[model samples]
Structures are given as structure tokens and as C-alpha cells.
Target: MLGYAAMNRTLREHDPPRRCNRDMRKKTWQRDGIERAAELTEQNFEDLYAILQWNLDHGIYLYRCSSTLVPWNSQFELRELPNYERIASLAESCGDLIEANGMRLTFHPSHWCKLASESTDTVERSVESVEHHGRWLDLLGLPRSPRYGINVHIGAHYGDKAATADRFCKVVDNLPPRARARLVVENDDKESLWSVSELVEEVADEVQIPVTFDYHHHSFSAREHSYREAFALARETWGDVRPVTHYSEPARLHGDFDARPQEHAEHVAAVPAWLRAESDVMIESHGKEESLLRIQT
Candidate 1:
């Protein structure tokens, strides 16, 4: 029930380190174009195949999807392009591989995807971001549920925590059914805002979005709850789907001199002793697959 993020660094069979292309530079969809988009889409799947094959061979069945798999996806308007379906078709193939291998897929949007921002424009943009993620899940033929979801954080409170939670729920209410069903909110690592308990009391209790717990985050903002107690509270939010949690060691906690306290370590420092039941973990580490390997061992 443990898996790493994209890019398995231990396997040299895949030549390039990562699959998503960020080489667009200053290219706009108008001039620098869909040509590179098409190329990267194809390249992504080819590289993805290798990663999937590696996972299947090694018995790792949980994987987090890269948000950048489709280049400029959220930034560009891509639906009208003639070859967009080709990209969708290829993505479907990748999804088929994932399903065939019994892997569970999840996506965490970039930090800027703030669903509860004070500004209406930012909230709308966040909605669009979630919708885009839902479309990809649709292309993959995945169900609209926490099983395959777009996990996001509650945005800045702008000085009013209660008002922010209300705004968060309003945005959730506005989301189309497809996007709404795919949403899961997580407790952040910072103490200024969300904790597992607060997310439940404020957001999940309001609109039914499942909570994704991060043990590392809990350590930072736990509110004195024991690991088992906090984990049990989080597990209750998932309802039907098995819970998925984020696990990582802080780099500074393990003797790294110059690292920040919240920065993820290259490998798992330690797992909580209370973790004995069945639940999936999306391993957040600098070391990728190599980190998961070490932790599992």
C-alpha cells in the first residue's frame, strides 16, 4: 500500500529522468504551438509505459499521476485542436495499462490551485483547474470518486478562517458534478491553517469532500492528537474508499544541515508504529521509487 511519485530514479532502463515536458519556454499556443504539445504527449506515454512496466514487475500498485503529463494542459486551451483526440486516445491507452496492472492513480495539483481564495477570480480559476483534472480522469475512464481524485488544499484565509471555510464550501457547491465528485481536500503542513480535525469540522462536514491526511503535516499541526486518533478521524472521512495518506520525512529532522524543517527528505525517516491496517500511501520524497523501496524493506 505504498508507492512513489513519478520518475523511478533507480531504474536506468528509462533514459530521461522525468516524462513531462517544460521546454516550451516562451512559446504561446498561438505561435510556439500544439506541435510540441503533440510531441510531448506521445513522449509522455512512451516514458509512462516504462514506469508502469517497472511498477508492475516490482509489484508496486499505487502511483501518483504527474500534473504535467499533458504539456501546458491547464494553461492552454486545447480542446479545439485537431489532434487533441489523438492525445486523449494515447492517454486512454496509458489508463488501460494502469487498470490492467491494478494500480491506483491520484493527482495533486500545484500549490496555486487554491479553492478557497478570497478573490472570486482565483476561486474560478481553481474551479477550472479541478475541471481540467476531472476531464483527464474521464479520458482515463476512471470513476468520479476519491479512488481517482484531484487532491487540493484550502487556500489562504485572508484573516478570517470561518469565512474562508464558508467560501470553500460555496466553491464546492458550484462545481459541476464531475469535478465535485473528484475533489479531496488535504490538511496542509503549515500551522496557520488546516489540520485534519479542522478540515473535518469546517469543510468535510459542510459538503462531503473526503480528507487526505498527511502524517508529516499532522506532526507539524497535530493539535495534540495521537497519531492513531488523528488517522482514525481521517479514515472516517473517506466513507467507502480506502484512505490514502501522505508520508515523508523532513530533511532537517534527519541530520541535513541546511534543509528547512518542512522539506521532504530523500528517504522515509520513519513510519508511525500504529500503521498496521490496509491503506494506501503516496510516498512524498526526493528519492522517488528508491525511497519507497527502502521504506518497504
Candidate 2:
């Protein structure tokens, strides 16, 4: 099965704009007034349901959800605001619908999460970000498994790849069980850092963490690894669960293909010859669902 990331902007998009409230937007933590907050939360649930239902109806069973469902979420004072039970009920219903239809759901938190950072503050914030995503999965009643993989990239190499990966494992070891259970690492887009082969040798091979292979990253990095080798390394870590791969073409804004190698184009890349027919892949192009449908057809 194939999936696309976040919302399908090319498709009908509906969003309720943020409203004015007593909420303070600054260095400190504060929340919008309860009544206003509840309205926003309800809006989020409705938007998600609309996207999920649309995907099912249109024959796209796999989808990725945005991590910012609740603004200023865990840092704020609001938890179960105006109608906690009601929203939780709705979230579970959404989960049931996905499971009933055999849809695959995924979450990709922001790349700013760097658990391997040498700074104590960076590590703390990273842990919080990961926990927030895990909590959302809980609200949706999704099982803590690769079926709803929470994918993230290991951050900057910090001049010592081995030490950085070791720090990553240590931080991951202490994660809340639910967050740890859903965690999966992807090879970074930068060539000088963690390539697919290096990632397997350093982290996934040792800790049994699932590896999400990104073909664009591997290509841009100038790595000699083949798609078959990449798929084998990732699939071994995943075991019976289907391994996920990412596909994207480079967007050219200037001189040549190398100008913006890391940026995803607004359309699908050609389906590679080695892509396993039974494997699950997610389109990372800027066109979102439009790119995904293009490649599938």
C-alpha cells in the first residue's frame, strides 16, 4: 500500500482559523480560554475525520497526520478542557474507523527533535516533543506498533557519529513505553552524516529500531547502496510488520539538480524498478496526495 504525508492540499481543504482569546503567545506557557479551546479541539477532530473518510472513499487507505493537532499542546495549562470525554470518544471512533477499513496511519514529528543533542535543554525539549506525539496516538487508541509508526530523523552528527548514535540509544531506552514502542528512525537527507547503511550498522541493527528508507536521501548522499540492500536492512528490523520507504524528487529552483537536492518537488518521482510491489511506501513530494496518486497509477 502507498501513503502520503499530512493533508492533501490539492484536494478540498477545510480549516477553522484561530480565534482571538486571552491566551498569551510568548516565552512562557499559557492557554486560550476554555470555551475557545474546546471549539478549536472540536474543529481538529472534524478535520481529521473528513480527511480520513475522504481517503477511504477515494481508495487511499494509508495516510499521515499532522503532529500539531492541538496548538501549544503539552506545554499549555489545558488538558481535557471544555469537553474531555466527548473529544476522547470522537478520537476513538476515528481510530476504529481506520482499523475497520485496514488503513495505515503514520505520524512524523518535527525534525527539530534531536534527542542526541549534547545540550541538556535540547534533549529535554526533544523528549517532550516525542511524548506529545505518543499521547496523540493514545488518544486515537492506535496500538503502539510499527502499524502506526512515529518516524523521526536522528539530528546533527555533532562531529562524532558513533557517540551521537550511542546517545540516541540511551535517550530512547528511557522513553515512555508507548513512545518507545512506536518509534522508527529514518536515514537523514545529508550525505556526510547518517546514510542508510551507516544507520543500520550503528543504531537499527543493535536496538532493533525500525529503519524507514528514503530513496531520495540515499541518492542525494551519493551512497553506493542499492534499493535492494536498503530494503533488506530495513525489513529485517521490521520483522513481520511491513517496512515503509519514502520517495521524492528534487525540486530545482536555480542552477542544477544539485542546487536544492534536499527539497522535494511538487510532483511524484518515477517509481523505481526495485520498489517491492507488496511493500508500503509514502510519497514525500510537496504535492502530497496528488503526487501519491500519480505514482500509483
Candidate 3:
């Protein structure tokens, strides 16, 4: 019932106890506390904690959280993993750990609408889903942990892209300003009419939200614009609130079907230089861990 701002204020007021627990202290240097707690929790918690622990151990503090698999399919009843309590507990625990480690956690909601047509149930559920997750972060006193982000497609243009943008803006306007601020629009695959530029052009004048640049989507969409151009457009459009860009290998097309992921050697080669200049990049690869290793190597 509380809007995101009030929820955040509540979380801040009820901040978790700061002193490290006996377990945290013992495992602090070993990076085993997160894993140990994860084993006691569910998969979502485990995954989140593992990522946090990995980042802490390696000193790569800046990272974001995404719920791509939380509500993995159209039937919202089925979650990727069943135990909600465990997931909630794990999230809370991870928040404490994150704070102790002096790191932040941001989130991205599932692309549920992308897989199905938009319906009242879909939109309402999506909104509810984000609020629910935000609460979990709040309960964990992590509402502000990663700074809460929900990335989404611009949706179909229907007959008019401007109308679609207006519709989305209205939808966004109704949300709690804190949540609205956290909501970011990502560039979609070629099938959609609303491109990143179009969405920005529509909302830039109205809201203070950022753009999420999906580089692979741009390549697959064949927008013919260079990465620099896209990046600059995002910067120009959003100003200080720059979009969080996604980088992944371009998918191959085989006839009407899309092929498995293919390596873009050139793209990979170019990332390091770009990354050096940028503050954040989310690797959206099927083989993300491997790709990160390759990038480092």
C-alpha cells in the first residue's frame, strides 16, 4: 500500500542492525557466509547472494540485480523456483551482506510482456510484481541497496508510436514517483515499432527516468547506427541519468528461426575500450560468465 518513497523511508527508519554477526565475521574473509546462507535458502536467494559474494570477494562492488527468471513464463502462477519464503529471506539476508560489504544492488524486472500481448492482468501483474520485489528489498532494508531499476520494452506502437508513448507515459505517471523514477525503457528487438530514440523523444520532456541501451538489440534490429551514436543519443536524451547499456553477442538467424548465440569477435574486442569509458555494462549472454572471463583474458 505504501508508495515506493514512503516504503524507502520506512526501510531507512527500520534499518537492520549494523554489527556483523558471528557468522559474518568468521566468513568475512573467506566469502563463505553468502554461500552458506544461500544453501540454507532458495535458488533466487542463492543466485543473488552468490553474485554479491563473488563481487565482494573480488572487489567488483558495482553490480545490478535482474529478475529475468523470477516470473519466467506467461502463467504467473509458476515461478522459476517455488519457495517464496526462502527467496524473500535470502533477499533480506543478501541486503544485510551487501550493506556490510559496502556495495549496492539494482534490479531489473522480467520481460514478461515481451512474450505475450499486453493485457490489464499483464500490466497490473507486472506492476504488482515490481512492488512486491521492492518490498522484499525493503524488508531486507535493501530498498535503496542497488537503487531499484525496472527495465522494460517500449511495447507495440499499435497504430501510432506517439500514442503508444503517451499511453506508456500515462501508465508510468500513475505509479509511485519512486518506482516511476526507477523504471527504465530498453530498446527492443526489431519487431517493435517503438525504438529507443522514439521512447526517449516521447518521455524525455516529461519524466526523469533513464534509458537502457541494449546493444545487441540494436545490432539485431539493424538500426544502422553505430554504438557511439546510440550511446550519444542515450546520453543526450537522458543527460545525467544515463541509460544502463546491455552488451551481448549478436544472435544468428537460420531461416525463420533464430540460431543460438554466436560470438562477435570484433564486438568483444571493442568492449574493453568502451567499458573503460563507461561506468556500467550488463552482459546479457547465455554464456555470460564465460564471456566475462574471455573479456578479462
Q: Estimate each model's TM-score.
A: 0.92, 0.89, 0.66
lDDT of 3: 0.52
Off by over 4 Å in 1: 11-13, 16-18, 21-23, 28-30, 75-79
lDDT of 1 by residue, 6-69 (tens): 6677654445564543335544556767777667766675666667777878878888877766
* Per-residue C-alpha lDDT of model 3 across residues 1-297, encoded as one tens digit per residue: 000000111112323411111122344425643344333335445555655665566544545554432422222332233455667666677878977875655666655643123467777876766654555456456543224456667656667766667767777777764466566677777645555566567865566566667766676443556767766666555455434576665544312234644333222333546643663566654443344445643
Candidate-wise lDDT, in order: 0.78, 0.76, 0.52
Write the residue-wise lDDT of candidate 2 on 1-76 in tens digits: 7888876674444344321111224333333445555666666776677778877877888888877665566545
- In order of lDDT, best first, we have 1, 2, 3
Tell me the deviation in Å of residue 275 in model 3. 4.3
Q: Which candidate leads in lDDT?
A: 1
- Cα lDDT of model 2 overall? 0.76
Regions more than 4 Å wrong, model 3 = 1-43, 62-90, 99-104, 114-118, 143-147, 220-225, 236-243, 251-272
